[model samples]
Target: MAAASGDNPSKLFAMPAIVADRRDDGSILIRSTTPLKASARCVGDWLEHWARQAPDRIFLGERASIETPWSTVSYRDARGIVRRAASWILAKGLSTERPLVILSDNGIDHALLALAAQHVGVPSAAISPAYSLMSKDFDKLKSMIALLDPGAIYVASTKPFAAALAAIAPLHRATIVSGNPDDADALSFRTIAATPESSEVATAFAAVTPETIAKFLFTSGSTGTPKAVINTQLMLTSSQQAKAQTWTFLEQAGEELIILDWLPWSHTFGANHNFNLVLRNGGTLYVDGGKPAPGLFATSLANLRSVVPTVYFNVPRGFDMLIAALRTDDELRRKFFEGTKFAFYAGAALPQNLWDALEELSLQTVGRRLPMVSAWGSTETSPLATDCHFLAKRSGNIGVPIPGTELKLVPSGDKLEVRVRGPNVTPGYWKAPDLTAAAFDDEGFYKIGDAVTFADPDRPELGLFFDGRVAEDFKLNSGTWVSVGTLRVAGIAALAPLAQDIVITGHGRDEVRFLVFPNLAACRALAGLADNADAREAIGHAAVRSAIGQGLARLKAQGGHSSGHATRALLLAEPASVDGGEITDKGYINQRAVLTRRAAAVAVLEDDGASEPIGCAG
Candidate 1:
């Protein structure tokens, strides 16, 4: 049910609809549509149709190191994998609701485990592989499992996940299932995958209905406890339909898309949503666990350099590194962009410079500039909502809602908040009815607490751009409101040439200052700047000058120098972390945590030490 419709030419045109109680302050109320019974068919149960129409086509992927470039895990094979995986999971003491959990690098095993969960009408919580291997943040991993109450947790045997999983096992309601074939305590994902092909997977799993729980994706939990959002079978199915419908509107047939992502499986971007969109139409997926920085991830990139994907999805940081590589390396550039058709970015804000660079490179390689677009959604919305399609228009706005989605702008004090309701949208937060009740308006429109504006007034079909998070915006002591989200994003872009990022200070303060982090690479490139004493002095000098210029420019851009955005000072040093005593895994700069850890830094911010801007992750 769409909350916003294309009928009203003033509010919404021939696109997605929005129905909200109109307010005087340039705002419209978006209300949810009445219930309608639609097909319960879900994307995870992909076997029924694919088995009949194109049983020979490749539906899932085989790893790069394997002998086959990709396996034709036909409709039949997919079903068999599901059946075997379901059987194996059930045999390992898993129940319908209490399902098998996977925390592995993205691969076919995910598809198998996912479908098996769908078949049995169970919701497999796909935990992030990064949490298990990459030690950026560890405590969150244990908390996520405790919330899910999974019957079994699965991990790759070769990886160090077993040890990590073991550390967190005491908190889990499930048994541990190792992905490795050699592990004595684990069920071999490979051996279970060897089950003979069968059509029974469809028929056997047909009992799943619209009400059946499809997935329980955990929110990124940046500021609070990790929330388990319920995803139903119909929710996923409708999202796929909406995605396929949106793709078809662009006049493109089914594409042989290949995506390489390491954004982590725990997030809906890499797990529940992106993968579902790919499988909706039978396409190839190259599971790349590569990192943009040098080391093992580099080796993975070297291996993937040969397969030029038709569809590429990467984060803003990763795109910067990839573009630099494409510009410098001829072989990589050719292989990477040769077959590349479209690119999508997410996980963070895409900087204007990076966006400009990508447009230029795409033009050079493809002879016609390819669209660099993205989408906006969360696990709360089943991770499918507004997609930024540059095909119709190329402004920076995130695209309109999928066919079934309804979005409205609920008027707030000097801000318009977003709200949506549709099959793709999740019902509510798990075991938090109070949260669920508070989450939606009277008309049942699920509130998305982000600020938005209609930048393109001429075309209502084009959706709005993000203004800021409602809570993240606050009033300075001077009574001037500060949008921290917008400010942080702009600060990162403004200092792109020098600083990596900045954390804005505006909590009960008269003006906002930044803790800036200088770009290590750029600092190295500055003349006379090295790790030596004289070099360090040179680096600090150049950095202070560059930072001062940026700060002044930032002040001017925000209007007058009196605006909250005007920088008061800058710290030449990077923020301390867990080891150094500053930042956390969520990229959260614990103000109190940092202040307690480094009284000197707090004193500096307070101007008791020096007028230095401490670098911080916003």
Candidate 2:
């Protein structure tokens, strides 16, 4: 078995004893022996507690541009604004039936309004801006608005969401609130926040219970329409409590927790996990306006240069982009590694090459390498079911079940399907009775549709590695199962700096093949082309194709079976479509949706006579 990282003594993570029980029916139940620490009943309690404890500490910050300084709000100021806005929300009669819906990116105003709604027992829902701004049809936004039947809708600016507003105007009767004062048809966010706090605000806050819904976080809708997963007060608080216990350094480190994040608030990883972690620990969150995309990453790099976070959080794609920047920019590498505790990654499995690159950079900049860790969960579990408290032997180890959570690993075909039951788990989907009924097992554990395997079969405490999604895995013509998650990560590593992401084909065919989305920038560099070269020209360059062929040849040499290596690959010029449900807001590719949407591309690989594909033997 591989050993854990050597930096265990430096970081004070909770070392809990893990208990696993093997059932008679070929299932395993795992839980931590440690009990969950007492957590706040509602998220509002954290805001109130911090206001009393350290009122002047900075809680949130944002910048309009790289040249401008961050506009910050302290804990005391946030509470005051939240209470006043809570009074306005109470006057508007928002409740479980009529919630507040926000359609904007991450900003200071967005965070304040969300806190205000939650302060007085009104649930808030932050919808992804892509559904409104990126999609041509606005079909997903309309469906979500109809399902919510919101009491009020909010936007940071009316100009960007004009088309979406016009599209959803016929769907609901919700009041409109705009952060921009120039919007004539909407109420001003500044005016609503200036409402005088009254006795009604305190009464509503006091009435809040653990069962009260705090937010409605939507799933990625990989298979179908996005389901509004009900996030209750218990789910939010308990997840943070377990996080605090697992990562004991949050309290023991003595330095205030700081994070510069770009993950969308519409998803659970950002809203429930990262955002709430800062709130619960009296930490400060700098709202990062940049993402991992091509044109937008410069903003993120600027933010990193400005603010050195105590704990940095990102998905694998973000890290991949960061690695490129860090390799070229010496100042960024130094600022990013200075005083950083550990790097956390989620939303997808990080390629092992990226992991090693980060470690190498950290060691080169600082004397020691930063511990890269991960966790596992979904939108339904308030996003954290398992915590990697210890540095695992390598990447993809999502540690043992957290406190107040249980992982039931039931035998499913050749894989173990992991089901979760915990206080952090959501009660059910919002207003979807049939979907809710089908989501849980007879034992009440939420079936997450993912599979796992023990890192070490004899020692349960070693943690669990994420097997591929049960729905995404498929069998070949010879009846051999193909693990898409594991193989995809390996393929990306094998085709490093060439393949951005890959979709495994040959579900029922004779051999596995790959539909690769080439990294255009990397291809351009490899081809020695100018920066303005067309994407198709870059991808079709002979040098780019030769590099892919060489990478495939390397992968073939280390293969275990036909299912393990792709014999041929077709590089796709077009990117994954957001409207087609091919990619999530967090950048996770839906394997089934990609395959379904690009059936013709898959066909090209299957056809032996196709000349577009590059063979592994080349």
Candidate 3:
């Protein structure tokens, strides 16, 4: 089972099997691996099963404080709390008509409340905390509140969200529920959780069917206001079942699984995928307080030192930071890789440099490279459609379609627009019938806006690589379509240690130009400066520009066409704005958002009189 930890985990990996049929109409039907049976009809069924079978097992845990010990809730205890909470919720007449709106980050209380609502046929929507706590204007928060019109709104604490709640107080008549009930308008979470379980709780639970709406997960809203993607019970259960089939190591390990997760429950990747993965498998989840941000990663490092997870999940940035830590901290390196069977990355493509660095560190610490895999899907697809179930040859290989899912690769311009049809996929968006109608095709497959290509066209089993978002790709003035995804990876690889991210801007222009967001730390290190050095000075350093020039030359030399490489580039000192939607909380860039937000930067890149632009050989 640990074979992938060192020599070759792929030997035990289920066969990389795929069946592909190409039609004369230029579409392909691709099916990979046999379908698996769903273990549960609804997400709550797993909680009930574990409560009965493994009553003493810890379901969830988190630290109360650095001075205090970790707080935990067993399956038996969780079920009791959930039942009591559900009774209180039902007493309030809260059903799917008026869903529960959550405004807190991951915690023991938050998870239980959300589960309890779903168990009793009421949908719970976990809105991103940034909308409530971080924003000063509260415009987004107001918009979300108006959309949800929830029967009750939950906040872990009142002080942080007090102002935002005040701003949106007039938007709806939701009953405010707070963990700290100091506010006069709010109900105490403890008071609600202590409600006596009534017969109505069982009746509500019995009425939940596979089609019941479990939750409403909002998209990152990179393009517009976040749309509430309706997640049904079938969607969640089917996705987990498909995951269980591919991840055979979990069952093989034969012990209760442990996870340290920081991904917000507001997002489907964390909520439906990571959260449900642990619960359905009868595993323990430690809600990580730390994030990939520089100051907060310390918390994660502390947690990792104490608790080594059997399987790890993170975005590319987290892995990037972890690789840096593992290089210097010997004890951390050992503990992180210790008994860890697999390393999973998603939210964005893992850079090849980071991928190679992790492999090298694993070789040094654990004497074998663990299977670092990724999956491709969206919130509408229940967060998983295609999974890299087998060993991939390189980065960006999103693998093949998972069991019980069929992928239709339709010809679109030069790329294949990937669409999925499966039980795991969502039926539609919440309260948006028109948008929902436009989301699927006549065959019932959801038109996921992403594109993909076979890693090896001859051998379909080799897996499929993410071709990039079909919407992000644009044409040049010369009528050549630029593959933004392919070029972005190449540009980043060429400019390693200098450019952290690049926004390709050449729509309707003669040539592609890059708005490069320099890696400030790397730039400062090369310039012999301190970590707190000014971003403009670090980016303006002659050595930094020279390194970027070399990278441009490299891209020029390896170019396939004018559209495949940038002709000029400019370093941008501005960071991606989370509020402006230029970047997501997960550190994934929104290409269209950045381009629209910084239209001036694009004009500057094309201006001949602007500061002498760095030029490539092409």
- Candidate of highest lDDT: 2
Error of 3 at 474 (Å): 2.0
Which digits, one per residue and each the tens of the lDDT, describe model 3 over residues 443-548?
9989999999998888988899998899989999889999898889889878887887889989888898899987888899999999899998998888888888
- The top-ranked prediction according to TM-score is 2
What is candidate 2's lDDT per residue for 80-118, written digit by digit as tens?
999999999999888888999999999888999999999
lDDT of 1 by residue, 1-618 (tens): 121111121221123443335668565743223223253376555665655556666665555552446443666677667777776655555654576677876666776777786776677777655566664556767777776667877776735775676667687677665566778876677776665534555454677777778777776554456677888887877776666555543213334455555555556776656776556655545566565443434645664574666667776656766776678877777666666656777655666667777667766766555556677777777777776543433424666666667777766777778888888888888778998899898888888778776656555555667777786677778887776656666666666655555555556767766655455555555543554434235436754456556654764475454443545445445434543324332232433344355555444665734634433222
Task: List clashing residue pairs in candidate 2.
Answer: none
Global local distance difference test of model 2: 0.90
Clashes of each: 22, 0, 2
TM-score of each: 0.83, 0.98, 0.95
CA-lDDT, candidates in order: 0.61, 0.90, 0.85
Candidate 2 lDDT for residue 549 = 86
lDDT of 1 at 554: 61
What is model 2's C-alpha RMSD?
A: 1.7
